[model samples]
Target: MKTMKMIAIPAAVLALAGCATTPGPDELRTNAIAMMKASFKERGQAKLDRIDQDDMQRLCSEYVGEKVMPKEIAQSLEKAQQALIKYPADGKLLGDWKLGERIAQSGVGKQYSDDPKKPAGGNCYACHQLTKEEVSYGTIGPSLYNFAKVRGYGEQIQRYAYGKVYNSQAFSACSSMPRFGHAGILTEEQLRHVVALLMSPDSPVNK
Candidate 1:
Protein backbone atom coordinates (compact mmCIF):
# COMPACT_ATOMS: atom_id res chain seq x y z
CA MET A 1 0.00 0.00 0.00
CA LYS A 2 2.92 2.37 0.89
CA THR A 3 4.67 1.68 -2.47
CA MET A 4 1.44 2.33 -4.40
CA LYS A 5 0.85 5.64 -2.51
CA MET A 6 4.39 6.91 -3.31
CA ILE A 7 4.02 6.11 -7.04
CA ALA A 8 0.60 7.87 -7.17
CA ILE A 9 2.00 11.01 -5.49
CA PRO A 10 4.87 11.23 -8.03
CA ALA A 11 2.43 10.78 -10.92
CA ALA A 12 0.13 13.53 -9.60
CA VAL A 13 3.06 15.97 -9.18
CA LEU A 14 4.27 15.30 -12.75
CA ALA A 15 0.76 15.79 -14.15
CA LEU A 16 0.35 19.15 -12.38
CA ALA A 17 3.77 20.33 -13.62
CA GLY A 18 2.92 19.32 -17.18
CA CYS A 19 -0.28 21.39 -17.07
CA ALA A 20 1.65 24.62 -16.54
CA THR A 21 2.34 26.66 -19.71
CA THR A 22 3.44 30.21 -20.56
CA PRO A 23 2.17 33.05 -18.37
CA GLY A 24 -0.92 34.90 -19.68
CA PRO A 25 -0.59 38.48 -20.95
CA ASP A 26 -1.98 39.86 -17.70
CA GLU A 27 0.36 37.70 -15.67
CA LEU A 28 3.34 38.84 -17.73
CA ARG A 29 2.35 42.48 -17.29
CA THR A 30 1.92 41.97 -13.55
CA ASN A 31 5.31 40.32 -13.29
CA ALA A 32 6.96 43.10 -15.29
CA ILE A 33 5.40 45.74 -13.00
CA ALA A 34 6.54 43.85 -9.94
CA MET A 35 10.09 43.60 -11.31
CA MET A 36 10.18 47.36 -11.97
CA LYS A 37 8.91 48.12 -8.46
CA ALA A 38 11.53 45.87 -6.96
CA SER A 39 14.35 47.43 -9.01
CA PHE A 40 13.79 51.12 -8.22
CA LYS A 41 14.33 52.97 -4.96
CA GLU A 42 13.12 56.44 -3.97
CA ARG A 43 15.76 59.00 -3.12
CA GLY A 44 15.96 62.78 -2.78
CA GLN A 45 13.07 64.39 -4.67
CA ALA A 46 12.52 61.28 -6.77
CA LYS A 47 9.81 58.91 -5.50
CA LEU A 48 8.48 55.43 -6.27
CA ASP A 49 5.50 57.04 -8.01
CA ARG A 50 7.92 58.15 -10.74
CA ILE A 51 8.25 54.51 -11.75
CA ASP A 52 4.50 54.23 -12.35
CA GLN A 53 3.64 54.32 -16.05
CA ASP A 54 0.70 56.51 -17.06
CA ASP A 55 -2.02 55.35 -19.44
CA MET A 56 -0.32 56.96 -22.44
CA GLN A 57 3.02 55.36 -21.61
CA ARG A 58 1.44 51.97 -21.03
CA LEU A 59 -0.40 52.09 -24.36
CA CYS A 60 2.68 53.29 -26.18
CA SER A 61 4.70 50.43 -24.74
CA GLU A 62 2.03 47.82 -25.49
CA TYR A 63 1.28 48.84 -29.08
CA VAL A 64 4.51 50.57 -30.17
CA GLY A 65 4.89 50.09 -33.97
CA GLU A 66 3.04 46.78 -33.99
CA LYS A 67 -0.23 48.62 -34.68
CA VAL A 68 -1.38 52.05 -35.65
CA MET A 69 -3.54 53.82 -33.10
CA PRO A 70 -6.84 55.16 -34.52
CA LYS A 71 -6.70 58.67 -36.03
CA GLU A 72 -9.26 60.00 -33.57
CA ILE A 73 -7.26 58.56 -30.70
CA ALA A 74 -4.07 60.24 -31.94
CA GLN A 75 -5.80 63.56 -32.55
CA SER A 76 -7.46 63.48 -29.14
CA LEU A 77 -4.16 62.88 -27.40
CA GLU A 78 -2.48 65.77 -29.25
CA LYS A 79 -5.42 68.08 -28.50
CA ALA A 80 -5.20 67.27 -24.82
CA GLN A 81 -1.50 68.18 -24.79
CA GLN A 82 -2.09 71.44 -26.69
CA ALA A 83 -4.69 72.51 -24.13
CA LEU A 84 -2.14 72.12 -21.34
CA ILE A 85 0.34 74.69 -22.73
CA LYS A 86 0.61 77.67 -20.35
CA TYR A 87 1.49 80.66 -22.48
CA PRO A 88 2.84 83.75 -20.82
CA ALA A 89 0.05 86.12 -19.75
CA ASP A 90 2.06 89.02 -21.19
CA GLY A 91 1.76 87.35 -24.62
CA LYS A 92 5.47 87.81 -25.24
CA LEU A 93 6.94 84.72 -26.89
CA LEU A 94 10.59 85.76 -26.90
CA GLY A 95 13.32 86.20 -24.29
CA ASP A 96 17.02 87.18 -24.14
CA TRP A 97 19.12 85.01 -26.45
CA LYS A 98 22.23 85.36 -24.29
CA LEU A 99 20.45 84.08 -21.20
CA GLY A 100 18.81 81.39 -23.29
CA GLU A 101 22.23 80.22 -24.50
CA ARG A 102 23.33 79.57 -20.91
CA ILE A 103 20.17 77.63 -20.11
CA ALA A 104 20.66 75.47 -23.21
CA GLN A 105 24.25 74.69 -22.20
CA SER A 106 23.47 73.80 -18.60
CA GLY A 107 22.10 70.27 -18.27
CA VAL A 108 21.62 70.13 -14.51
CA GLY A 109 18.64 69.46 -12.21
CA LYS A 110 16.12 66.53 -11.91
CA GLN A 111 18.72 63.94 -10.87
CA TYR A 112 19.02 62.56 -7.35
CA SER A 113 22.16 64.62 -6.85
CA ASP A 114 20.64 67.73 -8.44
CA ASP A 115 19.24 70.73 -6.56
CA PRO A 116 15.52 71.11 -7.34
CA LYS A 117 15.73 74.86 -6.58
CA LYS A 118 18.07 75.29 -9.53
CA PRO A 119 16.79 75.63 -13.11
CA ALA A 120 17.08 72.62 -15.46
CA GLY A 121 18.41 72.59 -19.00
CA GLY A 122 16.38 71.71 -22.08
CA ASN A 123 19.30 69.51 -23.23
CA CYS A 124 18.17 70.32 -26.75
CA TYR A 125 21.74 70.20 -27.97
CA ALA A 126 21.97 66.66 -26.69
CA CYS A 127 19.26 65.71 -29.18
CA HIS A 128 19.54 68.47 -31.79
CA GLN A 129 22.04 70.53 -33.71
CA LEU A 130 21.06 74.07 -32.81
CA THR A 131 24.25 76.01 -33.62
CA LYS A 132 26.80 75.72 -36.39
CA GLU A 133 29.59 76.63 -33.98
CA GLU A 134 28.67 73.80 -31.59
CA VAL A 135 30.28 70.86 -33.40
CA SER A 136 29.47 68.52 -30.52
CA TYR A 137 25.66 68.76 -30.81
CA GLY A 138 23.60 65.56 -31.03
CA THR A 139 21.54 64.48 -34.05
CA ILE A 140 18.49 62.88 -32.42
CA GLY A 141 16.49 65.79 -33.86
CA PRO A 142 16.95 67.88 -36.99
CA SER A 143 19.48 70.66 -37.11
CA LEU A 144 18.11 74.04 -36.00
CA TYR A 145 21.04 76.11 -37.29
CA ASN A 146 19.59 78.79 -39.54
CA PHE A 147 16.16 77.73 -38.33
CA ALA A 148 14.75 81.23 -38.55
CA LYS A 149 16.52 81.91 -41.84
CA VAL A 150 15.25 78.71 -43.48
CA ARG A 151 11.78 78.53 -41.88
CA GLY A 152 11.26 82.34 -41.83
CA TYR A 153 10.75 84.16 -38.56
CA GLY A 154 7.05 84.71 -39.17
CA GLU A 155 4.22 84.71 -36.63
CA GLN A 156 3.12 81.20 -37.62
CA ILE A 157 6.65 79.84 -37.34
CA GLN A 158 7.15 81.55 -33.97
CA ARG A 159 3.95 80.08 -32.58
CA TYR A 160 4.75 76.64 -33.94
CA ALA A 161 8.24 76.74 -32.46
CA TYR A 162 6.87 77.79 -29.08
CA GLY A 163 4.11 75.22 -29.21
CA LYS A 164 6.53 72.46 -30.22
CA VAL A 165 8.74 73.18 -27.23
CA TYR A 166 5.82 73.63 -24.84
CA ASN A 167 4.40 70.22 -25.70
CA SER A 168 6.01 68.15 -28.46
CA GLN A 169 3.04 65.74 -28.51
CA ALA A 170 0.95 68.62 -29.92
CA PHE A 171 2.89 68.23 -33.15
CA SER A 172 3.91 64.55 -33.05
CA ALA A 173 1.64 62.27 -31.01
CA CYS A 174 4.52 60.30 -29.54
CA SER A 175 7.58 62.38 -30.30
CA SER A 176 10.82 61.44 -28.56
CA MET A 177 11.33 65.10 -27.62
CA PRO A 178 10.66 65.87 -23.99
CA ARG A 179 7.46 67.83 -23.30
CA PHE A 180 9.61 70.51 -21.69
CA GLY A 181 6.87 72.81 -20.46
CA HIS A 182 4.10 70.24 -20.10
CA ALA A 183 6.36 67.97 -18.03
CA GLY A 184 7.17 70.93 -15.77
CA ILE A 185 10.83 70.27 -16.48
CA LEU A 186 11.10 73.76 -17.90
CA THR A 187 9.06 76.78 -16.78
CA GLU A 188 7.23 79.19 -19.12
CA GLU A 189 10.09 81.68 -18.83
CA GLN A 190 12.64 79.00 -19.65
CA LEU A 191 10.62 77.85 -22.65
CA ARG A 192 10.56 81.38 -24.04
CA HIS A 193 14.33 81.46 -23.78
CA VAL A 194 14.80 78.16 -25.61
CA VAL A 195 12.45 79.34 -28.35
CA ALA A 196 14.57 82.43 -28.69
CA LEU A 197 17.68 80.25 -29.01
CA LEU A 198 16.09 78.61 -32.03
CA MET A 199 14.14 81.52 -33.56
CA SER A 200 16.01 84.73 -32.87
CA PRO A 201 17.94 86.08 -35.87
CA ASP A 202 20.87 87.09 -33.67
CA SER A 203 20.98 83.71 -31.92
CA PRO A 204 23.85 81.36 -32.86
CA VAL A 205 21.33 78.85 -34.12
CA ASN A 206 20.30 81.30 -36.82
CA LYS A 207 23.88 82.08 -37.74
Candidate 2:
Protein backbone atom coordinates (compact mmCIF):
# COMPACT_ATOMS: atom_id res chain seq x y z
CA MET A 1 0.00 0.00 0.00
CA LYS A 2 2.83 2.46 0.84
CA THR A 3 4.73 1.88 -2.42
CA MET A 4 1.56 2.25 -4.57
CA LYS A 5 0.57 5.45 -2.70
CA MET A 6 3.97 7.04 -3.36
CA ILE A 7 3.82 6.26 -7.09
CA ALA A 8 0.24 7.58 -7.36
CA ILE A 9 1.20 10.91 -5.73
CA PRO A 10 4.10 11.53 -8.17
CA ALA A 11 1.91 10.60 -11.15
CA ALA A 12 -0.83 13.00 -10.01
CA VAL A 13 1.72 15.80 -9.51
CA LEU A 14 3.17 15.27 -13.02
CA ALA A 15 -0.32 15.39 -14.56
CA LEU A 16 -1.02 18.68 -12.82
CA ALA A 17 2.31 20.12 -14.09
CA GLY A 18 1.49 19.07 -17.64
CA CYS A 19 -1.94 20.73 -17.51
CA ALA A 20 -0.43 23.92 -16.11
CA THR A 21 2.29 24.14 -18.77
CA THR A 22 0.14 23.19 -21.76
CA PRO A 23 0.42 25.77 -24.57
CA GLY A 24 -2.56 27.90 -25.57
CA PRO A 25 -3.78 28.24 -29.16
CA ASP A 26 -1.70 31.32 -29.98
CA GLU A 27 1.46 29.87 -28.47
CA LEU A 28 0.88 26.58 -30.24
CA ARG A 29 0.43 28.37 -33.56
CA THR A 30 3.67 30.28 -33.00
CA ASN A 31 5.54 27.10 -32.15
CA ALA A 32 4.18 25.38 -35.29
CA ILE A 33 5.22 28.30 -37.51
CA ALA A 34 8.68 28.32 -35.97
CA MET A 35 9.07 24.59 -36.59
CA MET A 36 7.94 24.98 -40.24
CA LYS A 37 10.37 27.84 -40.77
CA ALA A 38 13.20 25.77 -39.37
CA SER A 39 12.67 22.86 -41.76
CA PHE A 40 11.74 24.74 -45.02
CA LYS A 41 15.12 25.81 -46.31
CA GLU A 42 15.06 28.43 -49.11
CA ARG A 43 16.01 27.09 -52.54
CA GLY A 44 16.08 28.83 -55.94
CA GLN A 45 12.92 30.95 -56.39
CA ALA A 46 11.19 29.28 -53.46
CA LYS A 47 12.04 31.58 -50.55
CA LEU A 48 11.33 31.41 -46.83
CA ASP A 49 8.73 34.14 -47.39
CA ARG A 50 6.40 31.50 -48.93
CA ILE A 51 5.73 30.31 -45.37
CA ASP A 52 4.21 33.70 -44.51
CA GLN A 53 0.41 33.71 -44.47
CA ASP A 54 -1.76 36.64 -45.50
CA ASP A 55 -4.90 37.65 -43.57
CA MET A 56 -7.22 35.38 -45.62
CA GLN A 57 -4.85 32.40 -45.38
CA ARG A 58 -4.45 32.83 -41.62
CA LEU A 59 -8.20 32.95 -41.03
CA CYS A 60 -8.73 29.89 -43.28
CA SER A 61 -6.14 27.99 -41.24
CA GLU A 62 -7.88 28.90 -38.00
CA TYR A 63 -11.25 27.66 -39.25
CA VAL A 64 -10.15 24.42 -40.90
CA GLY A 65 -11.06 20.88 -39.65
CA GLU A 66 -14.77 20.94 -38.65
CA LYS A 67 -14.60 24.52 -37.36
CA VAL A 68 -16.10 26.27 -40.34
CA MET A 69 -15.93 30.07 -40.26
CA PRO A 70 -19.21 31.91 -39.79
CA LYS A 71 -21.12 32.49 -43.03
CA GLU A 72 -20.83 36.27 -42.66
CA ILE A 73 -17.04 36.16 -42.36
CA ALA A 74 -16.75 33.84 -45.34
CA GLN A 75 -19.04 36.01 -47.49
CA SER A 76 -17.09 39.13 -46.56
CA LEU A 77 -13.83 37.43 -47.52
CA GLU A 78 -15.36 36.33 -50.83
CA LYS A 79 -16.57 39.84 -51.55
CA ALA A 80 -13.12 41.28 -50.93
CA GLN A 81 -11.61 38.69 -53.25
CA GLN A 82 -14.23 39.47 -55.92
CA ALA A 83 -13.27 43.14 -55.88
CA LEU A 84 -9.72 42.12 -56.78
CA ILE A 85 -10.80 40.47 -60.06
CA LYS A 86 -9.64 42.33 -63.16
CA TYR A 87 -11.69 41.55 -66.27
CA PRO A 88 -10.20 41.89 -69.68
CA ALA A 89 -10.27 45.51 -70.89
CA ASP A 90 -11.13 44.41 -74.44
CA GLY A 91 -14.27 42.60 -73.16
CA LYS A 92 -13.00 39.38 -74.73
CA LEU A 93 -13.02 36.38 -72.42
CA LEU A 94 -11.45 33.74 -74.65
CA GLY A 95 -8.29 32.81 -76.55
CA ASP A 96 -7.26 29.77 -78.61
CA TRP A 97 -8.51 26.50 -77.12
CA LYS A 98 -5.52 24.70 -78.63
CA LEU A 99 -3.13 26.88 -76.60
CA GLY A 100 -5.33 26.41 -73.58
CA GLU A 101 -5.01 22.62 -73.88
CA ARG A 102 -1.23 22.98 -74.02
CA ILE A 103 -1.21 25.14 -70.88
CA ALA A 104 -3.53 22.77 -69.06
CA GLN A 105 -1.42 19.72 -69.99
CA SER A 106 1.99 21.20 -69.14
CA GLY A 107 2.99 21.13 -65.47
CA VAL A 108 6.29 22.90 -65.98
CA GLY A 109 6.55 25.96 -63.82
CA LYS A 110 6.50 27.45 -60.28
CA GLN A 111 8.48 24.62 -58.65
CA TYR A 112 11.82 25.38 -57.00
CA SER A 113 13.56 23.67 -59.89
CA ASP A 114 11.52 25.44 -62.65
CA ASP A 115 12.84 28.46 -64.53
CA PRO A 116 10.93 31.55 -63.46
CA LYS A 117 11.26 33.09 -66.95
CA LYS A 118 9.21 30.24 -68.48
CA PRO A 119 5.41 30.46 -68.54
CA ALA A 120 3.59 28.50 -65.85
CA GLY A 121 0.95 25.84 -66.58
CA GLY A 122 -2.59 25.72 -65.19
CA ASN A 123 -2.11 21.96 -64.50
CA CYS A 124 -5.88 21.65 -64.46
CA TYR A 125 -5.68 17.86 -64.72
CA ALA A 126 -3.91 17.72 -61.37
CA CYS A 127 -7.16 18.65 -59.63
CA HIS A 128 -10.10 18.57 -62.06
CA GLN A 129 -10.86 16.14 -64.86
CA LEU A 130 -11.17 18.27 -67.99
CA THR A 131 -11.90 15.69 -70.70
CA LYS A 132 -13.36 12.20 -71.03
CA GLU A 133 -10.29 11.03 -73.01
CA GLU A 134 -8.12 11.41 -69.91
CA VAL A 135 -8.19 8.00 -68.20
CA SER A 136 -6.06 9.20 -65.26
CA TYR A 137 -6.80 12.38 -63.29
CA GLY A 138 -7.24 13.71 -59.80
CA THR A 139 -10.74 13.73 -58.36
CA ILE A 140 -10.22 16.58 -55.95
CA GLY A 141 -12.55 18.88 -57.91
CA PRO A 142 -15.63 18.32 -60.10
CA SER A 143 -15.15 16.89 -63.59
CA LEU A 144 -15.19 19.68 -66.17
CA TYR A 145 -16.06 17.42 -69.11
CA ASN A 146 -18.76 19.02 -71.28
CA PHE A 147 -18.37 22.26 -69.28
CA ALA A 148 -19.87 24.53 -71.92
CA LYS A 149 -22.42 21.93 -73.10
CA VAL A 150 -23.91 21.75 -69.60
CA ARG A 151 -23.58 25.40 -68.61
CA GLY A 152 -24.26 26.87 -72.07
CA TYR A 153 -21.55 28.66 -74.04
CA GLY A 154 -22.84 32.18 -73.45
CA GLU A 155 -21.07 35.41 -72.67
CA GLN A 156 -22.21 35.26 -69.04
CA ILE A 157 -20.73 31.82 -68.47
CA GLN A 158 -17.54 32.85 -70.28
CA ARG A 159 -17.15 35.86 -68.02
CA TYR A 160 -17.78 33.75 -64.93
CA ALA A 161 -15.25 31.16 -66.10
CA TYR A 162 -12.62 33.86 -66.71
CA GLY A 163 -13.22 35.42 -63.32
CA LYS A 164 -13.26 32.08 -61.50
CA VAL A 165 -9.96 31.03 -63.05
CA TYR A 166 -8.52 34.44 -62.20
CA ASN A 167 -9.65 34.31 -58.58
CA SER A 168 -11.55 31.25 -57.42
CA GLN A 169 -11.86 32.76 -53.92
CA ALA A 170 -14.21 35.32 -55.42
CA PHE A 171 -16.76 32.62 -56.22
CA SER A 172 -15.92 30.16 -53.43
CA ALA A 173 -14.34 31.34 -50.22
CA CYS A 174 -11.17 29.55 -49.14
CA SER A 175 -11.15 27.57 -52.38
CA SER A 176 -8.12 25.36 -53.00
CA MET A 177 -7.89 26.65 -56.59
CA PRO A 178 -4.97 29.00 -57.20
CA ARG A 179 -5.65 32.69 -57.90
CA PHE A 180 -4.02 32.54 -61.31
CA GLY A 181 -4.56 36.18 -62.20
CA HIS A 182 -4.77 37.85 -58.79
CA ALA A 183 -1.52 36.17 -57.73
CA GLY A 184 0.12 36.85 -61.13
CA ILE A 185 0.61 33.13 -61.68
CA LEU A 186 -1.07 33.40 -65.10
CA THR A 187 -1.05 36.39 -67.43
CA GLU A 188 -4.20 37.96 -68.83
CA GLU A 189 -3.81 36.09 -72.13
CA GLN A 190 -3.30 32.79 -70.32
CA LEU A 191 -6.48 33.40 -68.36
CA ARG A 192 -8.37 33.87 -71.63
CA HIS A 193 -6.86 30.69 -73.02
CA VAL A 194 -8.08 28.68 -70.06
CA VAL A 195 -11.56 30.16 -70.44
CA ALA A 196 -11.57 29.04 -74.07
CA LEU A 197 -10.66 25.54 -72.91
CA LEU A 198 -13.91 25.40 -70.92
CA MET A 199 -16.18 27.64 -72.98
CA SER A 200 -15.33 26.75 -76.57
CA PRO A 201 -17.63 24.13 -78.16
CA ASP A 202 -14.74 22.92 -80.30
CA SER A 203 -12.63 22.19 -77.19
CA PRO A 204 -12.56 18.60 -75.93
CA VAL A 205 -13.71 19.85 -72.54
CA ASN A 206 -17.02 20.87 -74.13
CA LYS A 207 -17.21 17.92 -76.55
By TM-score, the best candidate is 2
Alpha-carbon shift of residue 51 in model 2 (angstroms): 1.1
Per-residue alpha-carbon lDDT of model 1 for 56-167, expressed as tens digits?
A: 6666556566687778877887887788777788888899787788877777878888998988888878888878778787888888789899999987898888899988
lDDT, each prediction? 0.83, 0.91
Off by over 4 Å in 2: 1-20
lDDT at position 120, candidate 2: 94
Mind sharing the TM-score for model 2?
0.92
lDDT of 2 by residue, 105-161 (tens): 878888899999999999888888999898878888899999999999999999899
Clashing pairs in 1: none
